[model samples]
Target chain A: MQFKYDLEGGNFSRAGHASSEVKKILKQLNVDARIIKRIVVALYEGEVNVVAHAHKGVVMVDIDEKRIYIRIEDEGPGIPDINLAMQEGFSTASASVREMGFGAGMGLPNIKKNTDQLNIESEVGKGTVLEMTTMISS
Target chain B: MKISEIVDVLNARVVCGSDKLNTEVRYAFASDLMSDVLTLDTENLMLVTGLANLQVIRTAEMADIFCVVFVRDKKATPEMKKIAEENNIVILESPYSMFRAVSVLHDCGLQPVY
Candidate 1:
């Protein structure tokens, strides 16, 4: 099964809408509880990243018997250094975003931690694409 | 600890999802940062946060956290409560600070999610 959702930039109110919907789909499919949790964590983090940093973004989710694949593409100021961006204490979020209890620099790391496979590609001044995959079965 | 018990201990106000007050939670974590809350791996943990935004409830929902206690007397908006109601997650507002909320809940037999 596949699903697609659009995310708006700086729209904190709608940040988790996609993740929550994906979670329900996973539950209805009877994916393992542990696997669903991991996917939810990673998907939510990725969803929030787009909301916090992009002009707009798209989330594409594909699930099958073996693995669940997610791809998030955003039109934003791409990360200058993917290595630094992956670091735990690095973030470029504005103060207003921080005041809402986010932009603590843990978003990317949390996504990487929960997903078994993560690929991040970005070009400065252009955009970013994140692809994450996790096995549906333990 | 039951959600009802946490309410009593913290003198909190149940904003919504009163039907879930009898749910039992084994651990509690307090953080104003939603990112920090996402990294938690424990099961049946309740969140204590001062953030009253929509993301707090959304994060709790994604993490399978059944209850959230807003510390420092912060109250959630009606829209956030609506989301919690749909997700079946209980929302509680406490007058205590985050530190005091954690201390009180810990003393009341709620383990940390570390």
Candidate 2:
């Protein structure tokens, strides 16, 4: 099955809406609880990254019998240094974003830790795309 | 510990999901950073944070945390409380600081989410 959700930038109120919806779907599908938690955490962090940095973004999910694949594509200032961005405690978020208790530089690293596979592609002037996958088996 | 016990210990007020005050939580994590809370490995944990925004509830929802205690008299907005109610996650407002809340809960036998 495939699912898609749109993300609005700078909308803190709706930051985790997509993640919550996807979690409900996973629960309805009876996906393993552990896998569902992994997916939700990664997706939630990805969603917040988009809201904090991008103008807009899209979250796409492809679920099969064994795994779930997620791709988050956002339009905004892309990462200039993926390596630095991956480091914990490194963030370029605005002060307002930091006030919300995010931008502690833990989003991407947490996503990486929770997902079985992660790939990031970006252009400094254009945008970013984050792809992640986690196994759904018990 | 039972959520009710936590409420009593921290002198917290239930902002929503009052019916769930009896929910059992094995662990507690106190943080102002949602990112730190995201890295927690276990479920059935309660989050004690000073963050009063909707994302706090959202983070708790994503991590499968059963309850949230907003320390230092921080309060969640009505909208946040509504979301918590919908998700069956309890929201509690505490008068104690984050540090004191954790210590009290710890002394009362709730393990830390390490």
Candidate 3:
């Protein structure tokens, strides 16, 4: 099955809606709780990153019997340094985003931690695309 | 600890999901940073935070947390309550500060997860 959602940038309130919907779908599909949790965490962190940093974006979730795939594409001013941005304690979110209880710099690290495979492609002046996959244990 | 006991200990009001007061919680975690909460392995714990937003409920759901206690009398919006109710997550509002709320729960035998 495939699911997609539009992510509005700078809207902290709606950040995790996509992830939440995906979690609900995973639950209904009887996916293992552990795998569901992993997917939720990774997708949620990515969703927050898109909202906090991007201009606007879309989240696409593809689920199969063997694995779940997530792709977040944003048309924002992309990251300048993927390595530095992947560090656990690095973030560029504004004070307002911080006040909403995000931007702790753990977004990318958490995303990386929960997924079996991860890839990030971006251009400094154009946009970013984050792809992550978590395998389902038989 | 039962959610009812947590409410009594922290003097917290049920903001939503009152039917879940009988739910049991094994550990507790207190943090305002949603990212830290996500990274922490807090299964079946009650989250205590002063932050009031829809994302708080989302964090609790992602972590499989059963309950959330908003410390310092933080008010949750109707939308937050709606989301918590949908997730079957018990929501409580405590007038006590985060420190005092944690201390009260600790005194009542609710241990924190390090």
Q: All models: lDDT?
A: 0.91, 0.91, 0.89
lDDT of 3 by residue, B5-73 (tens): 988888889988887788878889999999899997657788999999888888888878878899999
Per-residue lDDT of model 2, residues A26-120, tens digit only = 99999988888999999999999999999999999999889999999999999999999999999999989988889999999999999999999
**What DockQ values do the models have?**
0.90, 0.89, 0.82
Q: What is residue B35's positional error in candidate 3, in angstroms? A: 1.0
- Candidate 3 chain B has its poorest 10 consecutive residues by lDDT at B39-48
Candidate 3: C-alpha lDDT: 0.89
Model 1's DockQ? 0.90
Q: Candidates sorted by TM-score, descending order?
A: 3, 1, 2
| Model 1 per-residue lDDT tens digits across residues B26-94 | 988888899899998888888988888999999998898989999999989999999999889999999
A24: Cα error in model 1, Å? 0.5
Query: Fraction of native contacts in model 1?
Result: 0.90
Relative to the real complex, the DockQ score for model 2 comes to: 0.89
**Candidate 3 accuracy as TM-score:** 0.97
| Candidate 2, B17-91: lDDT as tens digits | 888877888988888888889988887898889888999999988998879999999988988988888888999
